[model samples]
Target: MVCINCKLFSQLNKSVDEQKQKIEDMSGLMEEMGKEEFISVFTEELFDALSKMIEEKKLSMENAILLLKRIGYLKTLKRIHYFGFEKISLSERIEKMIINEEEKKEEKNEKLLVGLCECYLLFYSRVPSSEFLSICVPCLLKAALKKEESEKAQKEVEMALLALSNIYMWTNVPKELYLSEIKEVIQYHQEHHNLTHLAYQSVWAFFTDRMFFEKSLEEVGVNELHLVREAVRELEELTKNVIWMREKKDERGKETNEELLLIRWFMTMKIYLRHCQLQNEEFVGLFNSIVQMFRAAKDNFRKISNECMYIFLVAKGNLSIEIEDLLNGGVVDVALEEMQQPTLGYKMMCYNLEIINSISWQLKGKKKDEKEEAKRKATKRKVLEKMEEKGYEDDIFCFNEILDILNEVNFYDEALSLDISDYFVNV
Candidate 1:
């Protein structure tokens, strides 16, 4: 017998229950049906559903938003070539669907504007159409800049940032066109909320590839650019069970959970650090906060270790962090202790060794302040002493890999031994 439980979604209508059920079914449909079959059967219903949500008052705004959210996930399955929809009209009465600037989302609106923003994101690929950017940018900015102390407000901000992230997938977002507002939105979230992964990538790209290198971050008006440190501290509060998370890694990130948030969160920070400089105090505070997170995210140490190398590489003189800053931030202690751990996996070991190598390599470089030479030598001598004992343990089976890394980093082992002391030589 044909079952009601598996009723074909193509037979669905705009009735709230059926629409909701179909929205839920699309996830299964993506897996069960081939890509073309899924698109052919469901694409008409999908856009039609979005149109009904936009044009009709029958579906609750919550369900409408949920429908768009489901579509967003399902879109990942198909490799969309060009988004110029020929048969379907995505832009019909689209401008009227969005709430205008004068219209505050009052008690009566039922989040009508929120659904429209989601709809905007659904049609995001074609947003560059001449009139659409003008219509949508203001609506997005207004929502993006909203700062209220409630759940609903957070949702609006997230929607806007996620949308902005899409608007700015490239490094060359024009400063006056919409980027100034985009920058304001990023700063707003940094103070109040965390950005979504997509948003973080754009933010990273924006800052790392700043159009004018001579202009400081302050010059660009990201004067309160404590986003990275704030995000790191926020992570410290949210994280505890890295191993629990890793076990469900495949299942996680579908809803962009804590682990995925962290990976993207630091990408934004690392990208900024890669091309720009932070103040000495801020840089030290940021590194220490990362150390705190490293301590907290115990099982995810490998992830942290991989990211931490970027910070160390900055000391090779992106001009923000220095070797002494890393040393002061207790980097030496962490590397020495972690490198000796018998439990460390390959990537984790490589990261720890890289950290040690970066520190040693930078420490051996010439310092401009000739007066500080004696103190620098003393510091290097002390670090070498620790590495002498703890750097390379006897348990390593990855000898060739280790040797290869040694050669690449140009380890100065004039001592003619491949011991841990090989990390520094001649200096």
Candidate 2:
């Protein structure tokens, strides 16, 4: 056993070294090509190598985490999807490390603990092991709660909060663990310029998790309607901050970081809107914000527009929102315009079809007389006419497939019924 462990450690160290060297070599290239482009180009190669190492059982959780630390958090997150890191026994290993740390209480390694938390976060989509979370969550909470006033302590707290955010993305973090600390995390994010985005992400994740929202409402013994109204107010503040950042001019013409932050903000708001009932004015305001974003966003960020459209369609179906309301927001017009774009992908084409089918069904239900019925037919015809006029007739097959799908499935009902996990994947 001792020899086996030694061999594993040696192999893990070598793997980490190799990954570190690769990252160093890619640094110049990363600068020349943006991080996103670089990651897209090399993701397959990186994933293949990491997957092989894991499959061979040559990379232990400890070393895998060390490798992530070397590569940095964002890159590690992008690479892990290809690495299939979720298939490994990371939670068990991290749990063991936590136990060891507890045993050596006087010699605490905050860095290692933070790394373990980060690793667990990277695989958060997989539903991190309960044992690991039970241990790590409290450890992180404690670290975050420590009242050290030094810069090092502040950095450590930021890392812990980030880990907590990642944890909240999947699991319901207990109120006791976070209720006190979350305020501090938010304040730190507001006050600290360096890691504000990370802080905002953590807070957004915490607030948007269904479990957290429901639990908080229950704990406060407040009517969900009242609680949701308050929550919406907080979300508006968060959105305002993100929008302010996005409005600021940057030399690059496009601010990728700000745009991403805005996307995440909208995503969180979508979650809240889905899970909670809102006042009519609140709902309309939120819906309008989504449409405005869809209109203002660049073509490169079509996913944001797609997500906004999905949310609108889902709301229209589930909330019994009127066709007139949708038309007033120019939802139909926007859907037609998006569908006519030649560069739209197969997935987006499917999405646009879903939106059109949703509106068509709503209009059908609202038709009480021949005049209204005629209007519905004309509306559907207008969509087809617009498509033809925009030269989307070349993709007539896709349009026909969409009609068939509408016949088979109710898009809004199907979408609203899906897990948040499903919605976030395309986003």
Candidate 3:
């Protein structure tokens, strides 16, 4: 047992090191090539490489999942910035090809479908996502609703829901595109037992803070009063005594887990609670589930990835309710201690910068209660202390947009969704 654990730990570290080195190497090359030439070459190469892999059926399921996450992370990188992406003709070509592959497939190529959903997010800025979304939305819904019970099938369903959740979360999806299916979507699980716990979270997350169609949802007889309560109930069960320590194994241990889905879920949850209009009774019930997650995280050595989530949600959450629960549950102590160590990846690094910016903003809001205002200033001081606690510092995280948040003063009144586009991957 000890040897097996050692092997897994060693492999995890090796993968993290390789990813860090990849970022360092890419940064060096991009500097030499300059942004314009670099993006052009990178874009052309990506389409060329993926085309061959898909054509020859060389995209194994394992590689396909990795590719989806890689592309998603790569999309977040500034060097591969989307501004220049629109100028390139191949941007549209690649986007169309991803969708076309899904359209023409005889059997559902789960790999391709997964890739297509993530790729939609990758090129949403460059591609006309509206038209393609019109087609993909219903198709993805059909895929999610299928009754396949195999392990592979269940994973596909989970990924499909994850894709939908992310698409809705990041993109300002047009109401017309998915509004017709709103009632059916929220009500699907009520009648069926096909969705996983994660899937349920993902679907409810799809509607989080999307007020553009709230009236439309209500018009279709979707009851939010019931939906929010049920979601909270399930969350209570899913999180009971759950430890946010290890990545859940997938594909029979061939892979650990995709961090992006969980990250996306946290993002959705912050907004979900805000818009759910949590009833007094449900608020405490829902928060009890959240409190346990933090207790578990702190008890388990504050795993780096999950730690990112704690800070991410803390800084991003609007109301005092969610933030107070997290802080009181020991997120503050663990987050302060864990942050002193180096981060694992560019995503983790971006999140670190994000947490500082988000929390530091807490110091700037108006004085409501004298005690409350002093508490806000104190929170800022603690974050600043931990940031410099490690000693050596020199703008190691080069996120100009992120770092700028520290110096700015803004009121944290309403729960605002932070701009995710500002985040980057292996820069």
Q: Model 2 residue 118 lDDT?
A: 62
What are the lDDT scores of the predictions, listed in order? 0.53, 0.53, 0.48
lDDT of 3 at 248: 47
Of the candidates shown, which would achieve the greatest TM-score relative to the real structure?
1
Candidate 3's displacement at residue 412, Å, is: 8.9
For 60-136, candidate 3 gives per-residue lDDT tens digits of 33343344344444343322435344444444555666667667757756556556655554445543466667766
Each prediction's total of clashing residue pairs, residues at least 3 apart in sequence or on different chains, is: 0, 0, 0
Q: Per-residue error at 173 for model 2, in Å?
A: 3.7
Residue range 1-427, candidate 2, lDDT tens digits? 3342232233343455675564455444333444454344434345455546655766654556655543444543232234344444544555566667656858788667767776566545456666666667777767766566677666666566656655544565556655555556444544543344544554555556634445453333123223334334444454454443244434433334545555555555556545544334444445555666677653545556667776665665555354555655666667767777767665555566556555545544546789868876665565555545655444444565354444345433344212222211111
The reply for model 2, stretches above 4 Å from the true place, is 1-67, 70-72, 75-82, 86-93, 103-107, 142-158, 168-172, 187-195, 210-255, 278-281, 298-300, 317-333, 336-402, 405-427
lDDT of 1 at 248: 43
Model 2 clashes, total count: 0
Which residue pairs in model 3 clash with each other? none
Report RMSD (Å) for each prediction in the order shown.
Answer: 7.7, 10.3, 13.9
